[model samples]
Target: MLRYSAFSRDPAGGNPAGVVLDARGLDEREMLAVAAEVGFSETAFLVPADGGFDVRFFSPRAEVSFCGHATIASAVAHAERHGAGGLRYRTAAGDVDVVTARDEDGSWRATLTSVPPVVRDLAPQDLDALLAALRWSAQDLDPALPARTAYAGAWHPVVAVRSRQRLADLEHDVAALERLAAARGWTTVDLVWRQDATTFHARNPFPAGGVVEDPATGAAAAALGGYLRAGGHVPLPARLTVLQGEDLGRPSTLHVAVPADPAAGVAVTGAAVAMP
Candidate 1:
């Protein structure tokens, strides 16, 4: 297994992921064991398939349907060794297509096209429960953005706070949040503060995945793009930059592009660096 950090040029500045380049023979138990040993947020195991590869993501605690950072890290790692090109990833959520290219500065950037996204209203009870767990009042939320459940690859509650300080002061009941997430089939709670029309600050709580927070979550970024476009928060063909992990001292960036079509996949782009 190899270690790589996704969404940052520097290895220590992004979310770390374990990449098992060839995991043909490993079973579920062994994969879980390896993931636990690696102790990252998630690990990507690739098994060669006909068109591209079958990928499975395992967290330290359990298997998740999709993991954005691991996918980006794996694709960039693959590109570094094989060549920059398109890769079809067969994930549990769906078939995700990724393209990798080397920039002029010699950095490999990967863009993952998420599955068609969906945004739905947040149930009142669920929202109340979430607010209670975070010790946030309704006034702390952004009225323009509103609360909603978004799904691209994995489900996330996209909570837009009114202040960056509110987003930064992250204090939550981990067990309660984990229980709520597991019950709702949610992977993360995407807490965000819109800096401007095209820039945002985000922090993700991923207790269900056995992590306190995700430094850079491409899946949540894509979901946020879908939510913004669907709700007409941003204009069509919008390009937004999400700044994350600064509070944790592991800064990461996610570039999200939302097309005109609502049913189309959201594109998330970022760079990955091999970790020591």
Candidate 2:
């Protein structure tokens, strides 16, 4: 298994993912075991197909439909071992297209296009339960961005808070959220604070992954981009930046491009480095 940190130029800064580039013979049980042993939020298992490869993402506890940080790590690993190019990942959620290239500074950067996104309004009861689990009231929320459940491969509930401090001081009932997420088919509960037209700060609690919080969440970022475009929160064809993991001391930067077409997939870009 190759270990890599995605979304940060520094190895110690980004979210770490385990990449199993060749898993042609491994079954779901074995993959789950490996992911559990790795103890990262998620791990990628790849089986070489006709052109690109069929990939699977496993969290420590369960198999998630998609995992963005692991995908970024796997693409960079493939680019380094083989060469820089495009890759098609057939995941359980959907097909993801990734392009990897070496940056001018000699680091590998990858851009992954998610599946067509879908956004839904969160039910009042579910929203109330979510806020209660998060220890946040309706008054703590940002009026501009409403509560919604979004999907761009994996499903995430996006909640935008009014201030950065509210986002930073995130404390949640993990067990309650895990049960709620299992019932709602949610991968992560995204808590965010909008900084400006193009900048935001985010924190994701990934109870489904058997992790308290995900340091860098590319999947959530893409879903948020879709939500913004669908809700007309940001200007069409916009470039947005999501700052994450600062509270965890592993700062991560995720660059997102949202198109005018609400049916189109969002693009997320980040860099990955090998972990020692």
Candidate 3:
């Protein structure tokens, strides 16, 4: 297993993920053991296949349908070992197309196109429960973006806050959220503040993954991009930036592109580096 941090070129920044470049012959039990031992937010297992590779993501506690940071880490590691190019990933959530290239600074960056995105309103009761669990009042919500659930690879409830302090205060009820996540199939509760027209600051509470907070969440970023596009909050064919992990001291930056075509997948780009 290889250790890498995604969404940042610095080894100490971004979210750390374990990448098993060649996971052939390893069963789910073994993979789970490896993931548990790695003790990162998530670990990725890559099995060589005919066309591309079959990928699986596993948190320490359980298997996840998709994990964006791990995908970026694995893809960049693969590119460094092999060559920078396109790689198809067959995941539980859906098939993802990833392209890798070297930046002008000679750092590897990977961009993954999510599956067709979906955005929908959150139920009132669910929203209330989420607010209660988060210790956030309805008044804390931003009027511009209504409460909603979004899905690109994994499902996350998008809750926009008006202030950055609201985004930073993330002391939440994990058990309550775990129950809610089980009930609603939610992977994370995305608390965000729109810094500007083209920039956003975000914090994600991932109860389902048994994590209090995720430094950089690729799937949630994609879902947020879909939410922004669906609600017409941002101009069409827009490029936005999400800044996260600041509260955790490991700042992560994610570049998101929302195309004019609604049917097209959202693109998320970030750099990854091997961790010592």
- Model 1 residue runs over 4 Å out of place are none
Cα lDDT of model 3 by residue, 1-276, tens digit: 999999999998999999999999999999999999999989999999987999999998889999999999999999999999999999999899999999999899999999989999999999999999999999999999998999999999999998999888878888998999989999878889999999999999888888888999999999999999999999999999999999999999999999989988899999999999
Q: What is the C-alpha lDDT of each candidate?
A: 0.95, 0.94, 0.94
Provide the RMSD of all predictions against the true structure, rounded to 1 decimal. 0.7, 0.6, 0.7
Per-candidate total of colliding backbone pairs: 0, 0, 0
Backbone clash tally (model 2): 0
Tens-digit lDDT string for candidate 1 (1-276): 999999999998989999998999999999999999999999999998997999999999999999999999999999999999999999999999999999999999999999999999999999999999888999999999999999999999999999999998988989999999999999999999999999999999999879999999999999999999889999889999999999999999999999999889999999999998
Clashing pairs in 2: none
Q: In candidate 3, how many Å is residue 92 off?
A: 0.8
Candidate 2 local distance difference test against the native: 0.94
Tell me how far candidate 2 lies from the true structure as C-alpha RMSD in angstroms: 0.6
Candidate 3 global CA lDDT score: 0.94
Q: Evaluate candidate 3 by giving its C-alpha RMSD to the native, one decimal.
A: 0.7
